[model samples]
Target: MVNKVTVESLTYEQLAKVFDHAILKPEQTTQDVITGCELAKKYDAKSVCVKPCDVKQASDLLSGSRVLVGTVISFPHGNSPTAAKIAEALQTVADGAIELDVVLNIGHLKSGRVQACQDEIKAVIDACHAKNPDVVFKIIFENAYLTKEEIVQACQLSVAAGAHFVKTSTGFASSGATLDDIALMRANVPDHIEVKASGGIKTLDQVVDLLNQGATRCGSSGTDKILDEFKQRRGL
Candidate 1:
């Protein structure tokens, strides 16, 4: 388990390491992606989560930096056919994305087709691992559309599928990550699997609160503002 540290005591680097700076909006332009990568590099963020099409460019821009390039598979909807999602995962890895945040098939899970959902996730994980064994895979739950019990089941499936993390939302959902959800995910998953709180996280306090609740990473577009607030509070 990660040692708990007060928000005020965290250094800028420590705070930055938990962020996966997001650039996944549909309206985001190439320049926006470039700017986002710059911000990720500047902040030394853990990764820059970009749209699938932008993976190659993002990887090039982030070359020589510690920031990893990530992209979404099956994206916000998560309703894509399993074969399609697996193909997308392979293509993204070939495009230089070292991390993938894949949306779970919400429809299948909601319908109690747990085996199908787990199989789909496992397929993508296997494909990615075959190409690059170190590729990080985060399974997005889109918690706004799931019940507490469903969330627990999703976490279990994620671990069974060999996913590296269980994420909260897609940021397009009606709601995003909550402390309660993060805590629930933490309790359910094994120590090898981490929790990532994404969406609706705009403030430093919100990020810190999620971390306190056992979120190891976060996906946010407001990376600049949040880090600035951290710097201000810490007198950096």
Candidate 2:
């Protein structure tokens, strides 16, 4: 079992590394993306997960910052055809996104089409790596639609397909990441395969709780508030 990380014991840098700083709402304007990048730069977050269309602009704005640019593939829904997802992955990377949070084909997984799911993931991985071998790929399970056994299988497939992380949600799901689901993902994947918990994670305590449960990263739109709360609570 992974050892828990207490919030009070964490450094500011460690706390910063845990956030992806989501900016992916459908109605987010260009100004919103710019403001989001500014927040990411100010916090020195791990990345700013934006919509595919914002990849280029976000990358340009965050050019000299430590914050990497991330975009989604198949997005809130995982129903995009394999070829289309592959194409989207390629274009996003070319547009300058170095990290990708891909939604798994939930329909396929729920239908017990495990191989198909794995193949699709592999294809996207191949496409991303073809452009930048160092690109990070995090597979989104959207756990609200999955059973415990299905979650295990999805984790297995993600690892087998050479994904860098297994994410818990898209933030557009019926529910977001839970401590139980985070634990399940951590237990199933190897240490090298990181876990990213997203969706409904707004407060500092929630992020810390998920991290203690073995989440390596989190997706949240409230990066500034969360960090401020962390500092306030810690007297930093």
**Candidate 1, 148-233: lDDT as tens digits:** 99999999999999999999999999999999999999999988888999989999989888988999899999999999888888
TM-score of each prediction: 0.98, 0.98
In order, candidate lDDTs are 0.93, 0.93
Worst 10 residues of 1 by lDDT: 1-10
What lDDT is obtained when candidate 2 is compared to the true structure? 0.93
Q: What TM-score would you give candidate 2 relative to the actual structure?
A: 0.98
Cα RMSD of all models vs. native, in order, equals 1.0, 1.0
In candidate 2, what residue range of length 10 has the lowest lDDT sum?
1-10
Steric clashes per prediction: 0, 0
